[model samples]
Target chain A: MTLIAADFGKLGRSTLMSVASMLALAILAPVLVAALRADSIPAVKLNADQIAPRAIEELTGRNVTRDYAYAWRDLAAASESARADLLNDYFTGFAKDKLVRRIADQQKTGVRIRYIDHGHNVRALFYAPDGGEMQLVDNAQLEIEIRDGSKIIYREKVNQQYLVLMTPGADRWFVRSLDQLADHP
Target chain B: MAKMHSLVFVPALALSLVSSAQVPTLQVPARLIAGQAFTIPTHGQGEKTFYLLGPGSVVKRTVELGTEVKVTGAEIAAAGRYLALSCGSDGCSGTDFFVLPGDAVKISFLLHPSRVPVTAHNAINATAFVFDQFHNPVLRPVTVDFRVLPKNGPAFTKSVKTVQGVAWSEMSPAAKEGPVKVIATVGEQEEPRVIQQVASEACNLRIKARRTSKGVEVETDPVRDCHGNAVPDGTIVSVTAVDAQGRTTVDAPVKKGIARTQLPIHGSATISVASGVAIGNEIKL
Candidate 1:
């Protein structure tokens, strides 16, 4: 009888473990799917071979690339949702001001835009001697969509060019200026 | 990209986009310049929603179909890609355009090392960032005029063509130490920065010793730099005296212009004075 009781206890523990695992999976499934469907950061290929004044350090290059990708992600999210707060992390100075104002305009007119970024090929144009500022040109592959209320208004895929200026602050790089060029691939 | 009046720029950008139709369609001008107003043509009838998006500007409003939609200069002062959309019953049709930055009229100048030694070689960095009136970086190759003015020396000028909106020049502080003013100009805009060129290391340090009742007293001649400028007061001057017993050293600060120290000993000794990289003559007492 004692051996039977021990066997029953092992069965009970095993059942409990199985139930817990199933419950955990069930609870996390939606979140996992949502995260996967959420905005993915676009790849950025940074070419620093021709930067003047000084060469970029490996760590700096990595940080710049990561931060630039994050910036684009935030830009897409903020423009789509009309939430200016998302831009505060990676945009500063005139860049932030412009984006925030655009968000406000969208709120006023109930217009929305979303950037579906594919990737970017960026070339380093200038690097300040003191490392305070860096400028680059980015050729981006993107699919842009504009919406009005519940209606989809405009959509297109294009290879766009941009002139970007970044400054270091708070242990990261901030986009000070992001201007687009009229070049097509 | 003509020079449009600044007054009409705002209204042009304000009405830059609109379309009228059950299925909206719009056509934008081929060329747009920052801080310049523009007009666009739209198709369809009745009222429709207009939206314009750019790097630093966003415009959204209702517009009457078949009429011109104008954009204001203030609204389009930032240079970048612009999208103009017109939404109607059927769907939305839009056109995209690029706005080039206007001529550079401002210079943001950065000059490093506010204070440098006269002997420093290429220690002054002068970098100029050219900008349009809208504070947009000018991308074209504009010439930036650089003038370097040094106290007690001839002033010279150099012109550098900007690449990617920036131009830089490195300068060596003149041999005569004083204030050096660096100026950068783009079009009608000028930015000037000042740097102080101070004396370099002490030179020709000399020491004199005289017999005192207790021992020997040593003093340095007025400490001067190689350029004959008196070394600033409070500079450390080391005095070392060696005798039969051992060596006695006194670290003294230059007062007025000279440094003095007293060695308390009974016998004769050799005294030497040194300041910075300059070693003075030794004296036998």
Candidate 2:
């Protein structure tokens, strides 16, 4: 009985040692993997070409360009209701009303106006001293197609200039107003 | 049968005489401007009704024949074709007229390249469009005055007449760097805009290198233009080091008026600096 109890105690000690060693290995495995990863991962080298100037004008100009692209994309939808719903995400007040009215009138007249924004070149016109508002002038080229009763009536390429007003939001920016700087052809 | 025929014949004869005696005529101007009041002359005898229809509005009124009918600018504020019809007891007549845009009340002044390098030739373009209060482009000849005020120089002024409501002028930026105010004036209306005149590319850029603990430290002298104006901050300055091993280049931006970079050199390296098109001196250590 003594021999058997002594043998059992020895076995218990060995088993505890094995469990403790496994626990330690489990704890150190992640550290070892991380160190290996650190060795394999190369250091980040700064590329001169990748560095961009953080100018407010350039940043805001990009934002305005993107907003104009989105707005024009929304305006070219085939369905008036869908166009109105998408435009509400970008426009407000008189500009929204005018666009909605234009779409409604087109629907009533069985006419559709589609715009394809080729590109936009935006320049910062004015930024408020307090950074509350910014105005940008966008020179864009678009391919406009007018359809009547499933037939294209007219198609033309037009270069348009727009005066865009942007107001900063907490996380992003909002377009306050958009007006045509030049008369439409 | 004879009595009925006599009755019809007598009434038909009376109607023909009335129509012949009172012939309606309308006299109106060939063209009218939006937001202007005018009177229309007519000729007839008896009570007559007048109707005016235009692009966005319609007006109706009753007046005695031969009396002039007055139309207010508000009733004809829209620019398009207008029609006036007069219906008298005997006959009716209609006349048409065209409405032109009103006088200039606003101006949209656009200056291209809101930011330009100082002393650039013909780099700034100012374009102006005269607009009426109703946002219609006034397609009439008008003189636009462009005034450019530099931060620390004499103001430059130019006048250009508009063709088809557009006027534009190209001018060079000033020597000094700062905000340049551009103003466009048409009659009593004025529109002001600002263009940022930044320093031109670094000229005569030079640098120096010295031994540091890490390896070698390189720094540029105050980068200045040909006219001795300090180059603007955030302008890039490239530093390159070539050693026995290979070459390494660091494009550092000017901060606090100068650019500084630390290069790790093994031994006997040559270092050179440049800013834009201006190349600086080289040092071997």
Candidate 3:
């Protein structure tokens, strides 16, 4: 009986030792892995050649340079011949002295144009017939904003309402002028 | 015969008592490495019960599913003469089994650069985890593997770059530009980071055959700043590039308001701006 008890005790001791050792190994595994992590490969970097073109094209298209090209032509012509222009025409109850004074003041103060970014949503004003005339009544909706520093100088939506001079000879469209729509500020 | 029996019986009784008093007690010391997590469960039912005991008389440790724990130490004490461990929960019987410490949780988090658009020049930002086995993001010297394999063209792989502690890589450009995969690894962490990348996004560069004041020109667009924004003249700019093999190559000095070396071919150049440039309103290239 004594012999049997001794043997059982020895077996129990060995079993406990084995359990302890196994536990020790388990505890060490994560430490070993983390220590050796530096030998592992780092995340890779790729060339940006593929993504740049698409971003540039997308940004350019959204800015409306090609679409509003006709706006420049109308503004340039009307500004030169202020007498024939409706907004500048003296007979339309609009005074040339006020118009010239505004132009002279703009030249003196260097009043520039700018765009406003209304977060994700954008709204703006443009002018009729390329935006050269100073008629405050003929503003249209603009697709984009023209800016000068922090100030919003012009927009597309406002001018688009009064004048439909987008097509040059009913085909090509260009911005005739930039001064059609002016920001209040 | 009675005297002899008495002598033997007394010794036997004393020996039994002594043996019973010599129960072997044990306590195992352990620590959970930082930056890692582990899980341990002990369950018992009916007469057979199990108890997972820890330090500070803490009992009935509940381990939820998907939860990880850190082990500090373990002790085994019993009343038997043998070194047998008995697991018990109140009235339930308990068996002493080996408990392993959690080790897998210690590995660092590796990350991959997000998908950026393709540019004339190709570059990407990649990073690796900066941690040890203890789930601590400690700074350590590590080997990093960066790979940029072209998806459409020839296969190209770069040598492993050695990084110290945690640092970002310079802009790396590729000769051939197209769809490609970027992979990074550090320690046990692989591509797609446990954390963010160290480097910034690679710049997209292009060479345009544009109408210049001097004549028809094949050069990078002047309107777009180093960041590729349409800026007027006099905007300060800087451009940097890295190759496919993780080799950084900065261009020679920029003369005449242009800041980068132009490739003879029309397409293929990745550019990134570090500082000093503004985007203009009109085509101000």
Clashing pairs in 2: none
RMSD in order of candidates: 9.0, 23.9, 39.0
Summarize candidate 1's per-residue lDDT along B109-215 as a digit string, tens digits. 88888888888898888888888888787877899988998878788998998876788888888887688888898888888889998877889999998888878
Sort candidate 1 into its docking category. Answer: incorrect
Q: Show where candidate 2 strays beyond 4 Å.
A: A1-185, B1-31, B36-76, B82-95
Q: Write the per-residue lDDT of candidate 2 for residues A60-140, one digit (tens) a residue.
A: 555555565555555555232323565665565434654565555455546555566576656554454335555455565
Candidate 2 lands at a TM-score of 0.51
Q: How accurate is candidate 3 locally (lDDT)?
A: 0.29
Best model number under DockQ: 1
- Best by the TM-score measure: 1
* Per-residue alpha-carbon lDDT of candidate 2 for residues B1-285, written as tens digits (9 for 90 to 100): 111111111111101111233444467886677788899986656787676654334555787877889998876765544556665554445655666677888787778678888877888878777767644456567899999888888888899876545567788887777889999999899999999987777887888888888988889999888777788788899999999989989999999789999998869988888887778888888
Ranking by DockQ: 1, 2, 3
- Model 3 residue A71 CA deviation in Å: 56
